[model samples]
Target: MSELDDPVGSSLHGPHAALARRVGRTATYPADVATFCAVPADPAPQDWADLARLVGPGGLADLFTAPGTPPPDWTPEFAMPGRQLVAPVPTGDVDPRVVELGRDDDPAMLQLATATRPGPFFARTARLGTFLGVRDGGELLAMAGQRLHPGGWVEISAVCTAERARGQGLAAVLVAAQVARTAADGGRAFLHVVDTNAGARALYARLGFTQRRPVLFRGFRVPG
Candidate 1:
């Protein structure tokens, strides 16, 4: 396998590193950060530091802790530890159960998420692209959505399933649908997950996704 194909070397290192290395340089601003998706490269060390600051210490720790940020202890083993999962989606043979949702659907989606309480990023992701979900008798069970980065890669996020609906494969089905949509649009599907969550990681692996890399964020402190 090529260097990029090595899960430990490439995927496990996080997209920022790949993006920086691809461009042979580093991004200077938030807007420029998007460019790395289009042109992969190793993020300048300082840039990564700058980014951590922008996210704030609390936000940084929260993100590193899980697929979704809150409810603390929702998925004990899935707590974030400065790592994330970036998986590739195979479009063929998608599960028909998955459906695309809209902002108008926010109340239902948020309601489902709140019961499970994935994280704050879920609300932010709904603004990016079509949010996909699986419903059961008119109730949202599991959901995932897109977050575009520089138009090159679409981050698959907000993956959460209702506690009562676990083990139905709803999360996997929604992810496949979103990934198919992303690849069909000429962009790659990527996501962030906590380092531990073996169950979720195994699901992604079954879908042919190899772990890309770990990402950590530190918050920037405000001046007194």
Candidate 2:
């Protein structure tokens, strides 16, 4: 058949899906979108069968792979096109003020992330990877951190700055800091952004991130 015939082991196309299946807190939706959900990245045929059996009927999930690539027999609710950007080793040190956030900071992080609409930030998202943020006068101003870490690459995600703190380059610092940290660990840094977000794309460009490839995010609802 074609290269897309069986998308197993195809997570090289989407890091989020890969990371999700690897380290994400996975759960099935008991009450549809009203409850929690999980994703399987680059699922092999067996992986799809396993997840399908696990979730059963009355469940839903979301995952991403290369555009037009869904595992055999899985259906997609929607597909969102996006751009993937990769940054090289940072040239400077992370600012001293950027602090690592812990579980205690989830409340503030969730608020900031929700207000900024950077991406998904759930209650226990802190367990995903290292999250760093900047605080100004006791207020969370900006933040960014690791996401998918498959192989030698760590995906930088949740880069956001409070509205009151915009135009100050706080987002840049957080992104650069994440990139620097990833490099220090002997790994590369990358991220995914909606292709239509011109402002974010510009900022990432200025931070020395180049467009690596076009990606697609596919969300699916298992027959529930």
Candidate 3:
């Protein structure tokens, strides 16, 4: 069977396509197009052109890439850019203060994520996968989660810390824990962040992640 036929790869792609369709979006693969309702009703012509440019003249292979972003070197013809945010979880053992958030039903977790722009999607994705967090006393401070698992690759996402909790290294610690867990389970970690967020980029770099590529997300209004 071809790599695309692999169960893990197929499952990952299916979920992504489903989510996209629900939002009116469409993704193109070498063999087929995955259409999602998530795509905007009135997509700008440039949006389509950008998608074409990112996928290249030949079209996509096994992966997906947002337009205006470069594909990662390790990925094939279709490259998704924006560096995979990765960092080394502290060595030896997972910190006791860090905890794995089991489900989004927890009101506190939802509230914490809602404070950020990407949090809502992060919350939704976490429901389909796993989420990890760190706390001080009873308050949730920093958190991260898993997304887009194709083959041995797992994307680290929804990483955030409370606004008042900055400078405490809580984000670093939380990411480290997630990476360590992924590595232990024999999976590689990756993530996406807005290219303009220099501070967040620096933090990821300090933890040992390097820029893999740039990615873009153009949101359009869905026609009613």
Top lDDT prediction, candidate number:
2
Global local distance difference test of model 2: 0.67
Error of 2 at 121 (Å): 1.7
What is the Cα-based lDDT of residue 22 in candidate 3? 20
Candidate 3 per-residue lDDT over residues 1-224, each given as its tens digit: 32222223333356454433221133433222221111122445544444444344554323233222222232232222344444444366677788888654456666777775442352244554577888777788778776555566566767788899988888887778778888898876766676666777888888788655444323222211
Model 1 lDDT tens row, 127-194: 54578888878788889876434335666766789888899888888888877887888767777665
Residue 27 miss distance in model 3 (angstroms)? 7.6
**What lDDT tens digits, residue by residue, belong to model 2 across residues 62-118?**
555322333545566766788877897699778888899987888898889889988
Q: List residue ranges in candidate 3 displaced over 4 A.
A: 1-92, 118-123
Question: What is the overall TM-score of model 1 with all chains considered together?
Answer: 0.62
Q: By TM-score, who's the top model here?
A: 2
1 versus 2: better lDDT goes to: 2
Per-prediction TM-score, please?
A: 0.62, 0.76, 0.63
Better of 2 and 3 by lDDT: 2
Error of 2 at 204 (Å): 0.6
User: Which of 2 and 3 is ahead in TM-score?
Assistant: 2
Candidate 2 at residue 128, lDDT?
55
